[model samples]
Target chain A: MPDNPQVVLKITDLVKSFDSTKVLKGINLTVGHREVTVIIGPSGCGKSTLLRCLNGLEPIDSGQIELNGQLITAPGTNWSAIRQKIGMVFQNYELFPHLNVIDNILLGPVKVQGRPRQEAIIDAQSWLDRVGLKDRALSFPRQLSGGQKQRVAIVRALCMSPQIMLFDEVTASLDPEMVREVLDVMLNLAKGGLTMLIVTHEMAFARAVADRIIFMDDGHIVETAQPEAFFNNPETERARRFLNIFQFQELERRRA
Target chain B: MFMKAAWLTVSLAFWGLILSLIIGFFCALVRFWRWPVVARLAGIYIELARNTPLMIQLFFLYYGLPRVGLLLEGRTCAIVGLAFLGGGYMAEAFRGGFSAISRSQIEAGLSIGLRRFQLLRYVIFPQAVAVALPAITATAIFLIKETSVFSIVALPDLMYVAKDLLKEGHNNESNLLLVLSYLLIILPVSLFFGRLEKRVRFAGFGD
Candidate 1:
């Protein structure tokens, strides 16, 4: 998999610790070009930690993460340059509050990438229109709904034209009705062949969108399988136990 | 004569506020960015200015400096004194605003590939300024009041004329005029800050 030219991200023995607690314990994974990889796990299971580490938000104890055939975990790696290629969407949809929708979307492309303002705006307008938010381009972040903000955030990341996108529970904070709009965007992106590494609790959405679903627990990936097989028949007892208790199915199992 | 004295007070407060804003903004930036040598220097300056009385600061600038052969005009001393005292408060107000920004905001800026300097220029600064405006307004008003100490340097400011009038027979009229003179000076400043605050708030900054 490491030798495969199609692979966009490769992680080997990724380990991360915070003050003494080992949040990510020696994990290995690879994501292929345009593949939608979804990570699902219980709270504090290091799913979020893994995504953060991948995006260079946290320092790892000892490991290697290669993106697009470059070893990014090496010291002296230009993280700012690397981050442009790896777009990330936080759960909170941390939009720039002072900026209007168009400004927030154009900030990276124009300022960081040094693209001309007119050119960046043209691209931003296209993405906003794609997200069904072109009319609200003049609105500030505070003026948008949670779902709208999340969509705008997605558009902002997409404007960067990143090699891969990392989503860390992008819909976790939204109301139930708002969740679908965000999930629908992710599904559309998946269909559009964008490489994505997502950490989510939305099992149904995960099953629907992921080309491969990774189940993690206790700071490790316990199982990796196709959605249909993993859902219908989990291989390990841990996977089976997790799949049982993860949702309303747990109560049904107990009742049966 | 009273109008001239009040004008003197207004000019001192106005120039002093300008100098202090410049000094305090740079000090706050130096401290907020944690620039190695300057951060410590700014910290010591803030502590010294805040702990000591403005009168002592004026006396040191006006009188003590002459002993060291560094003489300055009385008006210079007054303006410099107010700047020295008020700068510390403004730096603190700015720091308070910087701290109020969430860690996520910084992270979001970094995520967008903004360099450290660019992050400050684009993200941290505008938000911090917005958050700091109210505190800055209070500091400006306080500095205007601190101009009362300018008379200690014998600057012939409003307070000096008020004291000068005390020696004469016109006690009630002098004191009342002194009080009104201050009102005339401070009221416009207070109103100006109020207008500025409304402008920033309307533009949707700080919160």
Candidate 2:
């Protein structure tokens, strides 16, 4: 990596533990500008933990995490400076239930960026329209469907205009029928050249949109390849087994 | 005769309900924010007000706190007593609301770069209010009926006022006036809150 390369995020030897159990064991990852990296792993494999650490939602036991070449994982790192450039979307919608759709979208820009109210509102309305939720501007989170709530979450993050966006299984909590609509919005964002790091179980979508697909197990990167090479020719036995299990689960779900 | 007494019952309830709500909400906030020694002191006040009988609490405040150097009139003492008692319950109400909200909501706020104060104002507080609304409304009604305790304090509130008129005008005159006063005060209040509850439900205050 150069002193100031085009890479938007860099994680080197990131480690995290809880009591006696270690979750992320010396993982190295990097995300580049205008690129989408999808991480896939079985349950309890620390993929979500990695995503959480990137956003400072979970503290890393030891690691060096840098966003846009600025160190963010040190004990005395400037969080406000780093966080202002990153946006994250969680599995659950996590929308503020009390706020109307428009208020939820407008909150980040106005409060954090200290943008003038009128300017923030204009940006929020544009993002709301982008998510195809202009009509729901006055509606509350409870009034929307699971897919609608997730879309609102995306629009809310986009309202801040982050340089990097992180998605942690955003579709995991949605109804099966509702996943596609949410994914459609993500695909559009990716096409527009937004830099994103996604943790997803949807291999088909990952293959369709992700530039690089990384597979992990027990906190180590098992393999990193282009989506075609990783999905078609997994180099390791662990990757092969994990792919088989995911395929079997998808088959069972479809049959049922 | 029952109808006339019902009216008297209603009016006194109204005075109690409104006054307690104001007291309860602020006290709940004091407990929630954990203001240094104030939180523990609020806890002590709640225990004293709750463990003892309401009637006794009214008597103590109307007759007691004054001798200790705090002088308050009859009605003031009664209102203060109701507020003190209601505040204890309100603390629990607000705490329940606070715990009900998930951490993910706050995380979302932080992810968007909102500072601590901004997160609480824009996210946590609004959701907490929504979560606490049901318990708050129920407590409000409870406080209203509890106003009858003020009679023991000799406050000129609805119940005590009705009682005074009853004592002076004899059975026929006092009965009708008591009933009328209660019907005028309590019924309207209950009706108002009942409608508000439905609005909160229909408006979908809490998700």
Best prediction by DockQ:
1
DockQ (C-alpha based) per candidate is 0.64, 0.47
lDDT (10s digit) by residue, model 1, range A1-256:
1123598999999999999899889899999998999999889999999988987888889999999899999999899999999999999999988888999998899999999999999999988887788899999888889999999999998998999999999999999899999999889998998999999988889899988989999889999999899989988898887777875665675798
Query: Using alpha carbons, what is the TM-score of model 2?
Result: 0.85
Q: How close is every model to the real structure, measured as TM-score?
A: 0.92, 0.85
Q: Where in model 2 is the C-alpha error above 4 Å? A: A1-4, A75-82, A253-256, B1-23, B26-45, B66-70, B205-207
lDDT, model 2: 0.79
Over B20-126, each residue of candidate 2 has an lDDT whose tens digit, in order, gives 55555656666766788887887787677667777887777777887898878766665667667777777667767777768888788888887777877777766
Give the TM-score of chain A, superposed on the true chain A, for all candidates in the order listed. Answer: 0.95, 0.96
Alpha-carbon DockQ of candidate 1: 0.64
Local accuracy by lDDT, each model: 0.89, 0.79
Span of 10 residues, lowest total lDDT, candidate 2 chain A: A1-10
